[model samples]
Target: MRSLRRTASTLALLGLLAIAGCGSGSGSDASTAAGGAEGVPAVLNFSAPLVGGGEFSGAAMAGRPVAFWFWAPT
Candidate 1:
């Protein structure tokens, strides 16, 4: 009886570990960026040519959530 209980407990633990291991890693990697764990860079400065006829500055977008997108052809 004791052996059965121990085996059941071990199986439950292994099951939990397996599920955890398969969980999403994106959240962790996103937070730990090049700047630091918070992933935000201080005094961030970026300028890019606008499609119409202007430039964009990262400083102007400070304090707002920003996302960068890229496309690559295979």
Candidate 2:
């Protein structure tokens, strides 16, 4: 009976997790005031240091289409 209870609790927890993991997919908060997403900033007030030298500016990349590449070690 205890094993059956544990199995039921595990199933219940999995169902809860699955439901919670689902997103609404509306894409509202993820956008800026100009409705731009993914590295498209509505305002120009950010910058970052380059890997080699100098610094990159966000103002330079605003209102333009660019390709972004990401690398990760798994």
Candidate 3:
């Protein structure tokens, strides 16, 4: 009974340590960037010239949700 108890305690301790290690950052640039604060907003701005010899400026889709789709020429 004592041996079983000791084994259970050891297993619990190992599980906690494993969880802590998994939660720690992986010490990589990509990992650091991925750990940013939740619900934070990111903004990207750009201006491109139109094919009809005009400039398109301003937020193309401000205050709106946008989805992008890509098509292949296959």
Candidate 4:
């Protein structure tokens, strides 16, 4: 009876350790999805004609902060 109790306790400990390991893997996956490994911004896609015109002239605000006002064509 005592040996059976000891075996049950050992199995319970092993099961807890396995659960902890699985939980840690999920946390790491969440961290990776939350913006790569860290210190990196997620890439975003933007459609264009980009708040300006078709001309690639030097008159465009390339390196400057520009406010974009979008309107639905409907």
Candidate 5:
């Protein structure tokens, strides 16, 4: 009976997660203000200071593909 209860609870949790995952797919006001979903920019132009020193420019790699990897010790 205890195992049956646990299985039922697990199934219930999975169903809840599945329902939550299916979002309304509607853009918020802030997203629309920032050029909406369809208005994605072709070129990313921004710069940020590196941790070790030096600035990274997104504009420099405008025509090329770029990939980023973020890691946290904790």
Candidate 6:
């Protein structure tokens, strides 16, 4: 049907746009840093306070993928 074809085309175009938006930008490569270990990103050089006590340092997890789950009071 014409309606089905139009819907499919719109979905395809949106998918392509989403993929393009996720692509890396023309910036410095994150896999290499001047003062960091080889293959480690400068983004790993961060420190954040833990909920209980102490601190969390991203440097402790260098060369590994990091995921954050942040919850703030509304």
Candidate with maximal TM-score: 6
Whole-model Cα lDDT of every candidate shown, in order? 0.61, 0.64, 0.53, 0.48, 0.60, 0.76
Cα displacement (angstroms), candidate 1, residue 25, comes to 2.5
Q: TM-score of predicted model 4? A: 0.32
lDDT of 6 at 42: 77
* Residue range 2-31, candidate 5, lDDT tens digits: 999999999999999899779886433222
The collision pairs in model 5 are none
TM-score attained by model 2: 0.33
Clash list (residue pairs), candidate 6 = none
Off by over 4 Å in 5: 1-43, 70-74
- Provide backbone clash counts, one per model: 0, 0, 0, 0, 0, 0
| Residue 35, model 2, lDDT | 48
Question: Residue by residue across 1-74, what tens digits does model 2's lDDT show?
Answer: 99999999999999998996797764333334354445555554456777676987665766564555534448
Q: Put down candidate 4 lDDT per residue, 1-74, tens digits, no spaces.
A: 99999999999999997887776343222212263334222221133453456633222433343445657577
Model 6 gets an lDDT of 0.76
Judge candidate 1 at residue 70 and give its lDDT. 35
Candidates 1 and 2 compared by TM-score, better number: 1
Report the number of backbone clashes for model 6.
Answer: 0
Error of 4 at 66 (Å): 50
Highest-lDDT candidate: 6
Sort every candidate by lDDT, greatest first.
6, 2, 1, 5, 3, 4
The parts of candidate 6 lying over 4 Å away from their true place are 1-31, 36-39
TM-score of each: 0.36, 0.33, 0.32, 0.32, 0.35, 0.46
Off by over 4 Å in 4: 24-74
State the TM-score for model 6. 0.46
